[model samples]
Target: VAKPVFMSCNDRQHSLAFGLPGMVERLNHLHIQYTDFDDLGVSHDTIRSKDIDVAMQLGKHANDQLYTFYSASPSGWLMELGWGNYEKPAAQEHYTGDIFGHAVEASGYGLDLEL
Candidate 1:
């Protein structure tokens, strides 16, 4: 199966909702397959717990370009952290970064959240 792309942030919040695909692609281009700097089953306060320099650098570049908080993208190794599958919660609020397919649109890449 093909791998799923996930966003990573230098900061603690993963819901920033911004430039992500480009960053991940950069990692892959460098032959770095491990996604890092993300907290899957671990505690939420461990940003410096692992080797995430590549991701950190990307975050710096991204932030420098957009001029906000850039350490928000995750490392290539982060993909291994695993953002477990969603089981369809009963009630929920639509968030900015939630995942949804744009089968209805030819251009695709629309951000959506489904409950």
Candidate 2:
């Protein structure tokens, strides 16, 4: 079984996102491989000691209230980790989509594999 380096349910308990260092360390420890890139799609090694970056970042959504991001796993699959999700059902009117955020920003490094 895979062990999570960090996880949380509510925004009050955890930060909106994980730091780069922690993500790198956890991915390395898990033997997962990923590639780092800038917004221009050029490879950028932000951390000199590590070779990984966030695959995608989907900001907090209005429906679930979850802030999530993705990282490329060794199997050529993206792994999503998120926090700040609603624990109890809050009474709210039905909505079709998120009010804001949750935009998709992919690294364009992974997502190519024969499955």
Give all candidates' CA lDDT scores.
0.25, 0.39
Best by lDDT: 2
State TM-scores per candidate.
0.20, 0.37
Per-candidate total of colliding backbone pairs:
15, 0
- Write model 1 residue lDDT over 27-108, tens digit each, in one string: 3211111133344223223433653322211211121111111122344322212233223223343333213321211111
The number of clashing residue pairs in model 2 is 0
Question: Residue 56 of candidate 2: its Cα lDDT?
Answer: 49
- TM-score of model 1 relative to the true fold? 0.20
What overall lDDT, based on C-alpha atoms, would model 2 receive against the true structure? Answer: 0.39
Poorest 10 consecutive residues of model 2 by lDDT?
28-37
Give the per-residue lDDT of model 2 (tens digit) for 73-113: 56544455444535433456444555455344544433211
